[model samples]
Target: MALPSVGTRVTYPAGDLIARARVLHVEPVATDDGERLAVLLDTTSIHPVDAGWPDQPADAGVITVIDGAALTVLDAIVAATDGETLHLGRDIPVRKGTEGWAFVVAHLVDAGSAIAEGDEVETRADALLRASLSRGHTACHLASLALNRALADRWTKDPRRDPLGSPDFDAAAIASSRIEPNGSVDRYRLNKSLRRAGFDATVFTGEYGADELRAAEASIDDTLATWIAGGGDIRIERDGDLLTDRRQWAADLEGGTARLFCGGTHATSLADLGDVRVRLELVDDDGTPTLVMTTRAHAPS
Candidate 1:
């Protein structure tokens, strides 16, 4: 089969978890243990883990053939290819949306799977896991906005503002973000550079103590509660349905509408995020101080 000239059409952004698609191509990828088969579809609802910024993991799912043979998808990843070669995940040499390149979602199955090109398959994601991840991703974004507002006074100079018109602390100081089941962990660096940017790192251990940190946490919780109580609508706006197109996560909050550039899935409304809370901790990484924020979302029982 010939490699696709255009990017794969993805439906996951619309909160789709199941799709029926035709196999476009299949190839064998050599792994450390052996070789694995990568199946590409004309269209897919399975969310693939991004290689550039892997904050949210891939969706767990299975592909079933028309003949009733179910093949478990081991993993899903972003794959890019030029006209000459196909690159999987981190192996790609060029950035996404490069000229003469096509980005695709590659579903990895066992090497011996009986699936082939031109096969009609039904792609299904684990609904329970998808729902949990959606909640976690939504909570992660909300917590970041609340944290920015809480620390808005810390910046002496005007920094880049977030969707809520507050100093973008999460964007400036974020080192890593990981989305987990019903929760997320974000790490921020309070090094010398942040101090030069007018952030008062000394507050963590000097003037600001555990009491101050607790107060900030409480403020974030209050903001989250207010937003959730409003039962605002949430939706994903996209420029197109292709894998590499731009997508924005938008929510109608109490103050106004907030939108942020994101590729992960999210819940349909703030009401779906029940009892959101965040815990803040300041720790030392070698000689540098780091701030960790752990956010959790408890679904309504």
Candidate 2:
């Protein structure tokens, strides 16, 4: 009737490219770029950009109304309502699962869209792009795990462990992660705090730093190759169907089942990853030394 009291039910995690949904509310939102119509749906297969992580971006898609008029979805983003007010993206004031707020996916269409509240609609995500992003996202996670293992010996002190039981260097140092078509770019901050945590940064800073980096890259590449060769099955497990519901990327590897909390779409199995590889680079960000890992994969044809 009004803004929903619960989160939007999401279907993309299950690899659905299309979904039938009902428009719960339609309102015009004034953004920095201008005004746009925000359509709140009862359910969606279109993956929206998460404001908190902003890693894997919103899926490109379109919504078809009953009259067969297709409205191009310019963007989709996470939106929330506290019963009285609606907030979008970074404008949301409270953390997810707050006492009374409902988190939903807001599909942005042109202000001139004739779609209105209570309309039944069908949302479709571009199949090719979805496949590419899924591959990139899966590769990104695998690459992070491989990199952590490659750098495990450098952590002198006991830090947290990842799903694979390696020192969680990726979690501890990651500054930002972005998923691209058939690839991903992740940046980690190598600062004083990392050294203070007993990470042997000297190896990456010493005269033989180049050699050490090359060794690490080779190790990571080999690990990925082995994992891919095993053809481990991959799937997304979820606690519920809602947008804010807890979901995980679960991969059944040769070693064991590794599960990481994730909110992105992924391939159904490792066989869809094709060849996953990553290149490591050390860059300077302002005055801080940063480690940038660029992961790429051949898209599954």
Candidate 3:
């Protein structure tokens, strides 16, 4: 079958939980004696990983047919093809607009299904689960900005700026960011290069007493509390619906607009967050210094 020539129109950015769509393609996938099926719909509300980033994982859901039959969507991933063969997940050869390729969301199901091309499937993501992930993702972003601000004084040299217009400590030092159900873990690297970049390494007070860490934690909380109470608006800005399209997290704060290029779900407003907090820990793992920030968001019932 010919591959889909255009990107999938995604509705998840608007907080859509369910969508009725036409099956554009269905292909059988086999790996190491195991088999799986990839289903592509004309439109989908299920958010897929960008393959490029993969920060926030896919939402849990199922596909329901007109006859009320359902197939549990075991996994959802971004697939792209160069008009030759469908490339699933990280196997995509080139970047998004490498000429003839079309990017799509590949909903993975059990192999040997009766589903075929032209079948209409109702796609639904678990709403409560989505909400929890959204909260986690949003809180993660907020914590990053706060952490950057708390560490801004360490960067002596002029560095890039963050969404809040502070020195881009987070962007420069960040290693990985993963979003979970109602929380997230962000890892940052502090190494010699950071010192070479004029970032004051002494700011990390492993040698300092407990009182200093507590004071720093209190400061971060104060900053977070102010931002949350200020009620910043959260919105995702995107260029297209394709899985690899450019998207950003825009937060409207008191002074100005704070935006970060992101591919994740988020709450509509800070008001949706009941209590958001973070715990910062500094650890030396295998001779490499790492900073871990754990963030949590409590949703009001």
Candidate 4:
């Protein structure tokens, strides 16, 4: 169909499980050996993976028609537009905010499905899975900040500050961050440049994994405990209701607040994140040092 002019309306921000929407556009996307169909709707509840930061995965959901027929929402991703064409995923030629471009969530389905433009569609996200991922993502952020603080004294030179204004070790040396169901794994590279950034590798290399990790967990859990006990709100702050709107994960701690520019779903408060812990491991890669932080959490019963 013709390129979409605007962005898709997403409903997952408010913990919506389903939404009634009108299909605004559909296109045949060619995959290996087959053709897949992409559908755009006036509104949806599925969380699409952003092209820039894909920390949390997409929600498991299904699309249905008013007649009770359902189509599996196989995959959903952030798509961009320049008014002249619709770009899917990393294929977007220009960066976001490249004047006159609209961002959207492109819901992909099997080609030749009966779904078409203007069809009233219902999008639903798996609530259980969403909750697990939410916990994992929240834990990930908390753990990173705590880890940075735990190693704050190691940085001799001034470095970029994190949300808490400490030396941003996590931001500097982070190699990869993957959020799993109720847990996350983050790796930090200890290369020459990281040494140049003034990160002490000995804490992980020589003999500081267990003690440092335990200390980090204690600090983080303490913060989370205070936040949970204080009963403040935790929510996703967004600029617009559209798919590519600037959003931040905001948490109101008892003493202060932490706001990170984020594009993932999160829990409502620290109460929803129960019993969080982390494990730090040191692995050497052909004479190079790597620190892996594994964070896990269990939601309250």
Candidate achieving the largest TM-score: 2
What local distance difference test score does each model get?
0.92, 0.92, 0.83, 0.81
Question: Residue by residue across 227-274, what tens digits does model 3's lDDT show?
Answer: 889887899999977666788999887677888888788899988877
List the candidates' TM-scores in order.
0.97, 0.98, 0.94, 0.91
RMSD of each: 1.2, 1.0, 1.8, 2.3
lDDT of 2 at 222: 93
Report backbone clashes per prediction.
0, 0, 0, 0
For model 1, residues 1-301, the per-residue Cα lDDT tens digits are 8988888899999999999999989999975657889999989999999989999999999999988689988888999888567799999899888899999999999999999999999999999999999999999999999999998888878888999899899999999999998989999999888888888776676765687689889999999999999999999999999999999999999889999999999999999989999999998889888889999999998
Worst 10 residues of 4 by lDDT: 220-229
List model 2 lDDT by residue over 1-301, tens digit each: 6888888999999999999999999989998778999999999999999889999999999999877689999999999999777899999999999999999999999999989888989999999899999999999999999999999999889999999999999998999999999899999988988888878887777898888888988999899889888998999999999999999999988789889999999988888888888888888999888889999998556
Give the distance in Å from residue 38's predicted Cα in candidate 2 to where it truly belongs.
Answer: 0.2
lDDT of 3: 0.83
The alpha-carbon deviation from the true structure for residue 126 of candidate 1, after best TM-score superposition, in angstroms, is 0.6
Candidates arranged by TM-score, highest first: 2, 1, 3, 4
The parts of candidate 2 lying over 4 Å away from their true place are: none
